[model samples]
Target chain A: MTLSTMRFTEAHEWLRPDEEDPTVVTVGITSHAAEQLGDVVFVELPEPPATVAKDDEVAVIESVKAASEILAPVDGEVLEVNEALADNPGQASEDPMGEGWFFTMKIADPDALAALMTEAAYKAHIGE
Target chain B: MAADLDAARATPLTGMLAELGGKMVSYADHALPVQFAGVMAEHTHTRTAASLFDVSHMGQVTVRGPGAAEALEALIPANLIGLAEGRQRYGLLTNSAGGIEDDLMAARLGPDHFVLVVNGACRDADFALLKAGLPGLEVSMAEDRALIALQGPKAEAALSALWPEAAEMRFMDVREAVVDGISVLVARAGYTGEDGYEISVSAQDATRLAKLLLAQQDVLPAGLGARDSLRLEAGLPLMGNDMGPDVSPAQAGLGWGIPKIRRTGGARAGGFPGADAILAEFENGAARSRVGLRPVGRAPMRAGIVLFADQEGGTPVGEIQSGGFGPTVGGPIAMGRVDAARAQPGTTLYGEMRGKRLPVEVVPLPFTPAQYKR
Candidate 1:
């Protein structure tokens, strides 16, 4: 259930290199986050091109049971949003690292990327 | 409300426990809710493979009397009299005003004995309702039994490997099977619209039975999270969410359960409380019918989202009652009550969510086609 290619933030957000645009890091919810939220019914993604600060809320996932916020990983302008999520929030679970990738960011602080958890570290941290 | 269930949890089977490294939350107060692995995965796995669900929290009650089936038929809509020995039926107990008392499954074990599986949250109230409605029948709340559903196309294969005789039973049938000498009542029925069996066993034997099933190659442990999503994807209605007292069976699209034989005038057959209102709905089309909805964008259309004729406010047409992202369909889907005129398949609509009107469409239900093993 762990995606080794993705880096995790303590806040439960995950980021990875965007295949369509390698320099852009795609951000999304981690599998653990989706599991915790249970049945996700609604999701709202910030519009693409919106400038965002690190830790800013970028998306919302609502379940019949609970609602959660998805935060940003870096201070940058949003390049594109996963519009598909607006219709299928379960994407957060099915392909959290790929098609479910929330948004892409042009790194404002490439050095901050060093602060994220390595695949092994996140697995251990979440006790996966 | 929780205190009521807390009292019932004093029994061994009702004590909540977390299994398989899954996280647990307070679901219906007494039961531990497994929210991990996602509802979609747990649900889809149960349909194509085998899933172990900790339904130990559901209420299992036995009613016995010379007229048990007749007593139950007088309260619920299912044709209990016609139910063959060792068969089950999904039924609804309703009040005189046409309000649902509770949705339950009743099984006939012998000529004058039956078992009722009721919703976890509604257990206490259902017991009270049954007692008041059928004063002559003896009802025994089997609080010591745990229920586990082993469901999917691979369910029979996996279960039969352990107890080969179960593979031959058809849908809605029940039989007594023993695994490692622990007795179980296996019923070929489930809420997820999948081919499965709901196995009832003593609480002390639940963990052992579950472990045995999970050890099998095809079985996976799923939680309530997946149970809800799977049932939604199959277009099945959840009692509290999709159909409550405010909603009638006709409006919820469950009119087919009413038998035509019951409609005839003679001895009046069953004396169900809501017979008049339900029969009227059957004769005359319902004012509002439940319809399947698909939003146009990637964001999900959720409950309370107002249904409008168009994005520019042609007029409020209806509202979403239940909505979710269907993992199997890979999109957002929902059920809503709308004007009969606007309920046709492929009709365009809009869902008002958070001050924004999103484009949507009216689609035929079962968002994803059901794969029930008939």
Candidate 2:
């Protein structure tokens, strides 16, 4: 999917539904959050198949300065995690929107996707 | 709650730091740069090349009078009597209960005159402690001076270009020198585990001196974030983080500061405060000792996390005193107080975070070997 089609969350996460499987959405933190957390060193992703409610603390991203929690933007079951991040967490900061995707989840409720902010709104939300 | 930034005290180099793209933060009621370029970038640069640090917030106290060393010795365990002129020694100000009040660098300038550099947060308390403890000694605060640290493998090359005399000094040596036509006191010591110098100059000339140093080809400005990581890699304990009024010299792995003359069977033994308790721990060993910890995975452990003796259902042993990602180590490293029985190098342990136990191993200190020009 193109950058314009991706949905953004207030918590600095981006979600884009898979073209072949609209029910499955990919998630990753925004570049703004990555910039604030200089030099991402470690990222702890939730195990696949784990169910999480919206706003739940589903992952952790640690940097040289501090550790921050990554919140789940919608209720869903994690289908896959970015295994590559385990070896090189810096990918989260280097290419946060692409290779840095934290996990893919199957949306529990399609209506919840509409509640997230759009790219335009997310940019204004973060004052970027 | 975050501190009011407007009310925080600014150092002499505050404007220079801001101009260098520093991300300012409130630390110990002072406005200081947390990072300039970035934490990891600054840390690695300092290790490989030269980096300048603005440390003006630290207190510089000068004490001179008859029997000054004798009076100061009563407060600390270090053998100040033997600290030769033009030499600096690491020391701790211990309380009556054997707890450390503050860790400082004491430099003997003369037979009865010494200079002390203390933590900024503990400046007032340390000044009061010295005044009240030794009424006869002339204890004056040098508020008009600012301290700057030039650290790393190439520090000498960058510094000696301005002050040729700095190249002749050995580790822990302190002397008055002229740099860029400015009178400054230079110490051949730093917290970064690299051979470097900490220069003390008039507050008015701080910005000018910093600019001159930064103009060097290999020198760049770093901040507190890089400073912390550098010291951690060097296995140096921060005053409030790794040690405090609750931790004694023995428990903090600072027994070396207590010279042999102050220990059992020496010329001067057990004269300082809490000597009985501290010396006993020195001989028999403290119940808990500070040790270096290497987390098994990529995840970095931080301060205040509970440490367990095993991976699962292990007893709570201690807590992390200081921890973070060590850029030089290429992974997460930490220092924590653990049961003495499990504080040995290569001993296996676990760090409990969010109910999950991560395997950690007790390692020797100076996680990276110190490169001092001894």
Q: Model 1 misses residue A34 by how many Å?
A: 5.8
Q: What proportion of true contacts does candidate 1 retain?
A: 0.43
Candidate 1 lDDT by residue in tens digits, A24-91: 78788777776666666667788888888988877777764556777888788889888887766667
**Cα RMSD for candidate 1?**
5.3
Candidate 2 lDDT over B1-374, as tens digits, reads 14566778888888889889998887767778989888998999999999999888899999999999999999888889999999999999998888999999999999999999999999999999988988888998888888999999999999999988888999999999889789899999998999999999998999999999999879999999999999999999999988999898989989878889999887999888888988998989899999999998888999998998878885789889999999999999999999888888998888988778899999999889999999
User: What is the iRMSD of the candidate numbered 2?
Assistant: 0.6
Error of model 2, residue B147, in angstroms: 1.0
Global Cα lDDT for candidate 1: 0.77
**Best-fitting candidate, scored by DockQ:** 2
Which residue pairs in model 2 clash with each other?
A: none
State TM-scores per candidate.
Answer: 0.81, 0.97
